[model samples]
Target chain A: MLNIAVIEDDKYYRKDIAGHLSRFGKVDEGKSLSDAITLFDARKYDIVFIDLNLSGKMEGLDVIKEAVKRKIPPIVITGYTSEKLVSRAYQLGCKHYYNKLDIQNSFEEQMAPFLRSLVYKQEDDIFSNSFVTRNNILIKNIKLVTEQMFLKNNKVFITGEKGVGKTTIAKFIHKFSTGSMDSFIHVDIPTLENNMIEPLLFGYKKGAFAGASDDFKGLIKQADKGTLFLDEISSLPPSLQKKIIKVVEDKQFYPLGSDQLIKSDFRFITSTNENVEGLIESERLRPDFYFMAKDVELIIPPLRERVEDVRPLVDHYINKSGTSLLVSNDSLKLLENYRWHDNVRELKKLIHSFCNCNTEMISLINLPEHVIENTIPSGQSTPLASVYTKGISNFIKKHGLKKLIETIEIESFKEFYEKNHFHYMNTLEELHISRTAGYRIKANIKKLDKERHLVH
Target chain B: MFTDKEKLLHDLNGNIVRLGSIFNILNKIENSKDQEISKNEMNQMLEDAEQTAILLNNDIKTFISINMNN
Candidate 1:
């Protein structure tokens, strides 16, 4: 069963939602903004249904902002519709937003798709052999349709650069659906020998070919009642694509050299790092196969975008090596900033290299010359004032230095305070600011901290 | 071009329907006899409608105040 939470001020609406959703999960209610904050902090619910306009001037946005930082997708329910509110909420990383007017009529029916996606899934799988990540958005996107994939027999198409764990996601879908890693047939299209592709996929009858002594069940048949994942799908031969079309549509096919039609019901998941349009236009990939696999598409972001995962990945590798080694903050910073062209594969390779080092802690000195050269130095930073060179010059040209200085005051204070070890008294004394000035700066810092979702 | 008054009334009506009053309307109709609408369902809908009405009234007050200023 799923754990669900609701944040709505209206008693009647609250009860309606609670009662309706109780069928799927235990309904926990929080009416006010404070309750919402507490609800988020105390227990991590699988899904949160939030009324977009909860009493205090769209306080729902505030709740959503908090939820996003926690990496929980908020299902926004509201009557007061605004493009601005929707855009802002999405910018803050809200995934599902629904209009109350439309949904209320058939609450259960309207939300069945999202609600039925209640398979037991963790955003991270750190405890298992496969790694977990803080990349909740990617995980949630896949999770949002996991139930539908199994229940409705929909195929999943995953697109990501090599080493971004497309196979891992495919396995996650099957594992969570079945609660085990069984009968997951993975065919790496690019790695398979060109001649072996046909015989391996659609197994041949006994004496079908020169070496065929016994009837071999195809990969498709092996994946019956399980998931069949085709990795690097663009590499699949055109001839195979034409032959597999029948299996894709009817879930039945003829084994090579056998007239008997075999029925194999398997969940299909295909992945490619290449652009689909390019593949289609160039005729490398057939459009029919692409469309069939593309019903529920998931795009995984590269490592550089998910900077939060860097330190954990580094730690995992170090711990796995059993060397009791650690990565220095500086080295981790450099690693986080580097453009991972090869994605996680590149990161794992780099981590493996670091494990071979003699030092207890892998620091900047231990990094490969090429790796260090490619990365931005952890200690160096470009001055913020120099950032809008053209715009700033124009602003100063038209307005003056006074307004520009005023604009950078908060930044200046932050820099000064940080330089003084973020100690208010020392920073104030060093800056020679009055007590009132210090108080205002401290207040602003608190405001900034809240805005950054550092404190609930 | 909807007038401010028209939009407000429309929004109010929409909320009223969404508050589960649509079920009540259905129950009143002869064709809706098939639905075994219970007292609990009716009560829940009425309670929700009443609270939303109050909230909507407050918002209308704010909108009227802003319009008066303009």
Candidate 2:
């Protein structure tokens, strides 16, 4: 049975909902905002039904926000039906919104099926794909895509930060889709050239353009019966976005300079690190295309937010490497503390780098200087260092040890001059350097600024 | 003071819907005469919706005050 919470200020409405929902789950009631929050932290809830207005305040929004942080979706059962209210509810991670008048009917149709689907999706046992994540929300969404999108042959739009496994999820969807053995073509939007994007994607007949000497096949034709994952689709030019929408709708397109139309059936899965709504608001993406692509949307949380997955991911990567090297607790703690800016991809890279250590165990001493620099030490008052030594280390790695010596000297000379309030003679004498050498150091420091801003 | 007419509409819409729901419950209890709902519970639901309406009314008044420059 589901553990459901009803957070409606109306005791009558609360009792009504709780009374009905009790048949499906263990029902809890929260008559006020503080009561709702207290009940929420008391246990893990399978679902929460929240009113948009509670106790004469917009406290329901706060409850929804808190639920989203815990990776649980809140179902809005407010009486309000305004577009703006509905939009805010969805933005705050509500999957369903029901107006109050039709509560009994909605429960019979929408709510019961939804709960059964959640149960059905979990018990399917289809998470053996390589997109390994222990996050409950990610697992739930993956199950949803497999059960809904793949079975229905619908499109899925994924949104997440870079390296957070959006593409991996797309591939996992393809593996379970109808044409599982067919091609899985990945099209990266940023790599498309402005002048050649059209011909590159839709192919070209002989003599279509000046350089089009031979017939060419494109991305769409390549994925004849399988999946086509469009990465960072918001970067696609608006004109091209419109054309792709037609191809998606009709499943038929003409190659450049060809009168005949070609048909290709392909499953569509698109992803972007950028905000889709923001892109549409700015008129960068067509609303029609957004509607077509967003049949089922899945969002992956960044690795930093789901830190519990770090140890399992590390172990998985290590076991996959065909070697058994244990991670020392100190090293593991540092790894856990370090903010993984690049998500799972960065973690994989860290593990890949560890293989070169040739040591039996990964210890504190074997960790990279930059990784150690980013990690926060326990029980320490000082924040992660603003001046990370990682930049200096990267500079040495990119340039050489020689450049490191020059950079240190330049910094030393500049520090002396600034400390002496730009008295050139006094500062140069204090550093025991000639005026000419000091001038050279000053020029070198200026050159360094022109080259790049180090020490981020 | 409300800068966004859209947001003000949303706040008003929420309260209006609450009042609508309260009225519907009151009507159901009156017409059916079989609702097991408590009379005190119905009174508090109405009171809660009224408080929301009053808050939204003040918001609209503030919006008018700012616009009229009174």
Candidate 3:
């Protein structure tokens, strides 16, 4: 069972929280900040519940700040109606927030499932048992590259297909490197339109713009000494890209309407689904920025490559939703075979919807038709016989056929080789191999060509 | 089962609550004194409230012994 701590000044509210949370796990109660701290030091609690207003010497914010400093996951339970305080609680890494007034009505529904999922219990000590040098979560080579980027004092360029967890990997880098229990400021470039980009990145001084009453510190300054993760970096306008390059290179930037230059020392971790080489070739992304970023680059593979992770992902979602659900082998196969164009994010949403809508048991009949339909090749398209004639015809005459066949397993190699008939690029496209894999195959072919020459 | 120490702790917590009520009342009087009463009287009341709040917090904390039961 998970161990939890509840800190609230109100006696009734504190007892109510303990009663509700006890249904899921063991909960210890503390009526003040001092009591809470003493209890925290005594044992390892999975989650902590903190109230924003307390009657004692210490305020609730003090408790939250202390919890954050101690690297504890805090859930803010407040009675205050101020939006500013609620937003600040979230900014300080309070995963869940609830109002005290509504505790009687919404306490169990909100806190129970959240408490269950918040506890990061180890299924087993895989990290210690496993020979892998990296953390347990980052098992793939692509994740290792991202972790290396975090260790090095350099900007990283993360490229992957959309929904392929590029941003998730970036967040992992941020969490590992900073060692601070603070939220990573995620900025999507496309979300900030051309007119808002400058103000969003660089704070505006008081009266800098019309109707400006107070000085504003932009996301960059706020994320100082932490990570400023720029998602969709390729979508940033040319002007902003130039400014970003300067700031990233120099670690100094002037705020809007400020004559004095401000320096912010923040790590820049950028991710884009666009092809970096293609972007540079089209003159959309700056070559100099690309070169600077090339030193630490991580290319996240699409979900199809890591089919082994699918079952775990499904289990993760089921556990996340706190629901008892099962997926049949056929349904699992359908999920695995389908082209996950949207990636993990889409899969998570689908699972969440299923858990919320469906009852206890989720079988093949209950599963969505689209999920099964999209997965089967025959369901959506004509049969393979009608599409293309399948036969081995003149293998030697086919250009690059031998090289393409060598890259793949011998069993399926001949089938795809004959299907594409000599066109290496078409084979790569049909098989959904990334451009990097294709280039590697091309390099191997060149090496083979030299060896053949020497033999002749 | 309530031990002698737990009983003492509960009584101390009750006293702290009583002291907090007194402090809140004095604070209100002090706030109103600035408009109607003299400056010296307001200052004296404010000091009394602050001292009372600190003493109550300290005494109650000592009575409870945060790690007593745990």
Best by DockQ: 1
Show model 1 residue runs off by greater than 4 Å. Answer: A1-130, A357-359, A376-456, B1-70
Clashing pairs in 3: none
Kindly report the docking quality category of candidate 2. incorrect
Q: Which candidate number has the best TM-score?
A: 1
Rate residue A74 of model 1 by lDDT: 82
How do the residues B12-52 of candidate 2 rate in per-residue lDDT, one tens digit apiece? 55555556556656676677755657778867777787797
CA displacement after TM-score superposition, residue A382 of candidate 2 (Å): 10
Instruction: Give lDDT: candidate 2, residue A160.
Output: 92
Per-candidate Cα lDDT values, in order, are 0.72, 0.75, 0.65
**lDDT minimum window of 10 residues, candidate 1 chain A:** A378-387
Task: Identify the runs in model 2 with alpha carbons over 4 angstroms from their true place.
Answer: A1-126, A129-131, A376-456, B1-70
DockQ of all predictions against the true structure, Cα-based: 0.07, 0.06, 0.04
Give the winner by lDDT: 2
Candidate 2, residues A1-456, lDDT tens digits: the string is 356789988665676667567655457899767887897788677789998778767788888998888766799987566677789889889988987766744567767777777645534444543535778887778767755765467889899998898887788777655334479999888888877878888999999999999999978998888888889988889999999999989999999999888888888999989777789999888999889998998988888767778888889889888778889988888787776767888888878777656668889887766566556455441212312334667766776778667756775676677789778999989999888888888888788555432312
Candidate 3, A272-313: lDDT as tens digits: 898777888887788876776566777777775556656678
Q: Kindly indicate the candidate among 1 and 2 with the higher lDDT.
A: 2
TM-score to true structure, per model: 0.51, 0.49, 0.48
Candidates 1 and 2: which is better by TM-score?
Answer: 1
